[model samples]
Target chain A: MSEFDLIRRSQEVICAPGARYRAQCVLGIGDDGAVLELPPERQVVVCTDTLVEGVHFPLDTGPAAVGHKALAVNLSDLAAMGAEPAWFFLALTLPAAAPAWLEPFAQGMARLASAASIWLAGGDVAAGPLNVCITALGLVDKGRALTRSGARPGDLVAISGRPGAAAHALALLQAGRVPDARELAALEFPQPRLELGLALRGLATACIDLSDGLLADLGHILEASGAGAELELGRLPCAESLAGLPEPERWRLQLAGGDDYELCFTLPAARAGELDALQRRCGLELTVIGRITAQAGLTLRAPDGSPYRAERAGFDHFGGYRGEGSPAAS
Target chain B: MSEFDLIRRSQEVICAPGARYRAQCVLGIGDDGAVLELPPERQVVVCTDTLVEGVHFPLDTGPAAVGHKALAVNLSDLAAMGAEPAWFFLALTLPAAAPAWLEPFAQGMARLASAASIWLAGGDVAAGPLNVCITALGLVDKGRALTRSGARPGDLVAISGRPGAAAHALALLQAGRVPDARELAALEFPQPRLELGLALRGLATACIDLSDGLLADLGHILEASGAGAELELGRLPCAESLAGLPEPERWRLQLAGGDDYELCFTLPAARAGELDALQRRCGLELTVIGRITAQAGLTLRAPDGSPYRAERAGFDHFGGYRGEGSPAAS
Candidate 1:
């Protein structure tokens, strides 16, 4: 198919007439560039993430999940910043222009985009390996947006939802075994926790989306904030489906395995009650997994207060520092 | 290398301390998302374009040129909309994290970003096939950005710079022949006509960036504006470097070529003299090679007013429509 045909059909599928930001887009797809209007006094937060076939997802993953995960991951970043996602541009490089594939892929993307009240602004579809790159744009109030560098030594490190279900599901998939429905759903359609992130705003000291598991991603907040953390591993909200795994494997999957789109944030002791309130409001577990410390390096403690360690830190796409029987190089 | 380390090195290289929109960026690379403050009265223009290895460029092309072209093409889209290029997010998927390749690549992208007064806000570096997708964000005053649908039947169609050099240069490179330095530069470092696009904002009726040659790109303007065009072949400004090619080949390169980062727009006859001033002000060709017609299809007229034709209209990345010795499956 011609690029123009792909664009026209794709545009038809993604045009959200009821999108929250529809009126803000002066001109959208079909133009060389999309024109969007920003409200006065708001800061625009932008994030770009890429999901490559076999690298970010399994080679045989469904097109719909691929599409869902593509936008989901980027929105996760915006959620990390307490940003309200309004629009996104998708660049899809596919082996061919298959309508059967694009239909479901775009539907998956549109479903998430509509749920988030965001519009698909514009992008390109080219011939190459199956790859999806999405650039998400969102808004946040001035001085209210969360960042990784805001954690204080006394801040309590908290995470939203069960953080490691996706990792366990991926492991199950790679092992050629059936995964728990919830775990598989977590792997394929991880929620962005947008409402929770919005709630965190001025409440959470710092925030980040967990893509590279809990330990490594939290390490970013620590490194940027010039602080460290100590996590109570027993307090970690691991999926119940992982109970059959060996102790170390469960710990690694929960702490060091990748592909969790949950939010890990830091909150002060004074704001702990506010988080509990937010937990009920957001309908997700808001667990205080640890505390930010003055010392460097991430430390973990078992339920009995013994030091705990993982075989590997986390998945690094380029370095390929992942556990055995795993292949998440995102 | 770890993704964090790559991001760190890349952040260091792309840290434009003196960028035009530096003050507008509340946060840049290293954050979950870059927070940018948009001017209230201006519209944000966004465009995303991707370049795949051995597709957009020769596999042997220098890392710097690849990096330069990666950002340049997206900026060209913003330029087409008469937007003031400001910030961009790059999602680069590479086979390896070799500093040897990255240094020059970052430097090359940095050079253009600095020249255009834009900043590398934030992005992702993943492990995959060599692919670069850039999402550029810029701004244009309200109600003033150019669009493809604004042309009138009587408008004068014009283009800036010689449009055939890049196509000819690629042909030469593919044939294992040395190309003219100027043509090579056109392919490797085609300058986006930002100033010309901005100048055309209030004057030109419609505008587009000429990437897929004159015929195909101009065809977009025609289709969008519900008008047609008649080109005077002899009036086209072909580079002197392409004069040695055969008659048909020369004409094909000039009219049906690709990768010319020039501005093509339609100006009303009343605005004709103003275009002359813009041509002088911009110090570019800005040649009027055709006239928009009330008819519905693009018509080609030879120097003697006879009908002219070419083997292919232009390169379509997915369709792979092109002439012999062409490999631009971009």
Candidate 2:
């Protein structure tokens, strides 16, 4: 199909309920650029992420999963900023136009977009090695958007949901073993935790998504906020899951594995009671596994009080540390 | 280099003025996402474009030129919408991180970004074949954004700058002939008519950029506006440049060339005189070559008033027609 036809057809199937722009979009799709009517007193948030084939996913992976992950990772970034996603632009480069792949990919992406209330405003299609680059735009109230530079010396470091499930699923798949339904879902259809983000607007001091490993992504927060962290391994969320693995493998997957798409944020000690209500509302575990410290280093303590260190580093596309973490996103 | 280091290093060189955000941008690089404070009463314009290595430009094209064109093309889209360029995100995919190519590429892009007063807000880098996709965001007065659907039957058709120089330069390169300095510049460093676009905010009815050949891009405006256009070839802006070419070659290059990044718009006949002052203000010649008609097809006429036809269609990435037009963008 021609590039124009593919765009039109993709829109037809995706925006299946006739065609109408979302409330905030002044114009979409057919224009040289989509126009958005910004809400009064709101700041716009933007994050871009790209996923390449054979690098992000296994060659045997389905197209729908790729599509879901492409938008999901970007949405995760917006979630970390305490923003509400409104629209996204996709720049797709494929070796060729195959309806078999494109159809399911569009459908999968449309599902997430509908759930998130985000519209596919505009994008471009080209012929090249398969690559999906998406730039998601969202909005937050002034002074409410979260960043990684707000952690104080006495803040609590918290994470949403079980962080190592996706990494574990990936490892199982590589070992030619089947993961449980929950693990598979975590790997394939990762949820963005957007509602939790919006709820954290006035509560969390600093935030970042767990795309890099727990320790690595947390390292970013410490570096930016000029603080350190102390973690209790027994306080991690998935104790039952870790019980089955060996000590070293358990620590690596729990502390150093990536692709969780969970939020790692800081809350001042005075407001730590705010989590009980948020946990019930968001329907996810809000685990406080660590505390921000004045000392300038990470300190890990085992259940028996022995110190420990995470061996494997997080995945880096250029650093060649493509370990058990995600082969996909940042 | 690590991905974080690369991002940090690139930002340092790109934002050399001690890393200050533009007035509109509240937060920039080194966050989960950048935050922008939209001006009151303004609509935001967004456009995304991608360039794949060996697909958008010749394999031998320099890295600096690729970087310039990657951002320039998206800026042209904003210009077509009569929006003021502001900030952009770049998603760059590469097989490897080589400073030799990346240094010049980043410098070339920085030069244009500086000249346009647009900043590198934020983006992601991944390991893959070379590809540069840029999503540019701009702003226009509420209800004043130019689109392709506002042309009236009696509106006069106009285009800015010379159209065929870029295509002619590419043709010369293909034929093992060297293009003159002007032609080379047109092909390498296209200046998006952003000022003229801003000036035409309330004047032009419909507008688009010449990236997919003049006929094809104009076809989009006509199709959307439900109007037609009748052209007088003798009135085309590049008469001097066409003097040395064969009659057929002259028609093809002038009417079917892409990558010129010039603006084409429809203005009411009464406002045609406004171009005289606008030309002086923007320092680019604005030529009126045709008028919108009630009829529904483009009509081409020779200088002697005989009918003519354009043969090759516009470039389509998947249409198997990689002809004289740009192998680059839509």
Candidate 3:
């Protein structure tokens, strides 16, 4: 198919009318640009991420997974910010216009978009090495959006859902091991905690998504908030698949693994009781694993009440210096 | 520098305060996402474009040029929509984080963002083949945005600025020939016609940016509007640099060359008079090149009124059918 034909086909698959998010988009898909109108007193939250073929996913990964992950990652960012996923713009680069690839890819994106009520707004397609760049736009009530700098001393640092499952699945795939269906799902179709994010808008002190491993990503919050954290290593939530692993291996996965797409947030002591209700209401796992401190560095605490040190921090694309006790090394 | 350091340096370079567009961005750079608020009664217009190093720019092309063009292309899409450029998100993928490259690229983007009053909102950087994808956000008065599907019979087709300069420059560069500084600048830093676009808001019936050559891009407007167009060959504006080229070469550049970043629009017969005043006020070259017709196919007319034909349409990455009389052959 021609570039135009492929775009038209992709549009047809992803831009069905009557989608809940369609109401926010004044104009979509076929225009020079997409038009969106947010209700008054709302702030728009925008985030963008690019997933390159080799660096982000395995070459053998299906296009559907690639498409789903591309949008999922951006939604993860919005979830971190306590925003509602509304619209996204995709910039897809392909070596060729392969219909075999485009169809499943669009289908995957359409499915996720429908579930999230997010509309594919506008995008560009070019001939190049395969890459998918997505810019997601969301909305939050004015001044209610979460940020990493909002954490305060004595706040409880918590996480939603199991973290590190995707990274563990990635390692399993890399090792040529056939992971279980749940592991494969975690790797290929990790869900962003959008509802939890919206619920935490007025409650969470600070929030971030686990994409670059828990310790490393949480360090961003610490740095931004000028606070410190002491994570209870024993309390870290591990995926069910990792339960059979050795203690060290489980620790590595829980602390250093990336691509989990789970929300890590901080709540004040006064609001800690709300976690149980939120978990029950949202049908999500909420675990309190740490506490914010006035000190200016991160610490890992073992169940024996001693500080634990790790060789490295979280994953750094440029291999920078890892923070002390960072779980970057596996 | 490490990825974090490089991002910090880039943020410093691109997010300097006091820039006009920075006010619209409530929070930027350091967060997981950027936050923006538009005034009441305005609609947000968004578009995205990606530039692969080898495909969109020469391997040796300077980082500054790549940065400028990456954002410029998205701006051109906003221009086509008759939207006022407001903010943009950048997703930069690099084989490595070389400060030498990142600094210049950030500088170039900063320069253009300053000129256009568009803020650099939020983005992600990762290790991969060099690519730059930009998503630009603009704003238009409610119900007044220009679109490709609005043209009608008897509307005068018009182009802003010279439409073939960048393509001509690309041809010269591909031939290993040194082009004039003017031609090189056209290719490296082609400006989006923002003023003309904003001015055309209610006046132009249809609008598109000439990124895929005049004939190819104009065909989009025709197809979207369900109308035809008859181009007056002599009236098509050609860059001064092309004056020395052979007739066929000039025609090919004018008709099929891509990356022009110029605006092509249609003015209804009654609103045609606005073009002359807009050109004079904006100090731009606005040329009436054709007329939208009730017929359903594009045609070309010679100065003497005879039909004209060409070997191909505009540049198609998938090389499909080209419209007749399109100067895609050089």
Top candidate on lDDT is 1
- Sorting all predicted structures by lDDT, with the top scorer first, yields 1, 3, 2
Q: Residue by residue across A172-262, what tens digits does model 3's lDDT show?
A: 9999998898998898998988899899988999999998888888989998898888889899877789989887678878887878899
**TM-score of every prediction relative to native:** 0.96, 0.94, 0.96
Clashing pairs in 2: none
Across A242-307, the per-residue lDDT of candidate 2 in tens digits comes to 568887788788787788899999999999898999999999899999898897777889989898
Clashing pairs in 3: A313-A328
Which sections of candidate 3 miss by over 4 Å? Answer: A16-18, A320-330, B16-18, B320-330
DockQ of predicted model 2: 0.82
Between candidates 2 and 3, the DockQ winner: 2
Quantify all predictions' global Cα lDDT against the true fold.
0.86, 0.85, 0.85
The 10-residue segment of model 3 chain B with minimum total lDDT is B321-330
What candidate 2 gets wrong by more than 4 Å, as runs, is A16-21, A176-180, A239-243, A322-330, B16-21, B175-178, B239-242, B322-330
What are the per-model DockQ values? 0.79, 0.82, 0.81
lDDT of 3 at B105: 93
After TM-score superposition, the amount by which residue A51's alpha carbon in candidate 1 deviates from its true location, in angstroms, is 0.3
Q: What CA RMSD would you report for each candidate?
A: 3.4, 3.5, 2.5
How well is each residue in B1-330 modelled by candidate 1, as lDDT tens digits? 677789888878876667889888889888889999888789999999999888889999999999899999998998999999889998999999999999999999888888898888899989999999999999999989999999898899999998799988999899999987888999999899999989888888999998888778887888888888888888988698887777678889888787998999999987788877788998987899999889777778888999876577787877777543212111
lDDT tens digits by residue: candidate 2, B5-39: 77777776565342233866788988889999888
What is the model-wide C-alpha lDDT for candidate 3? 0.85
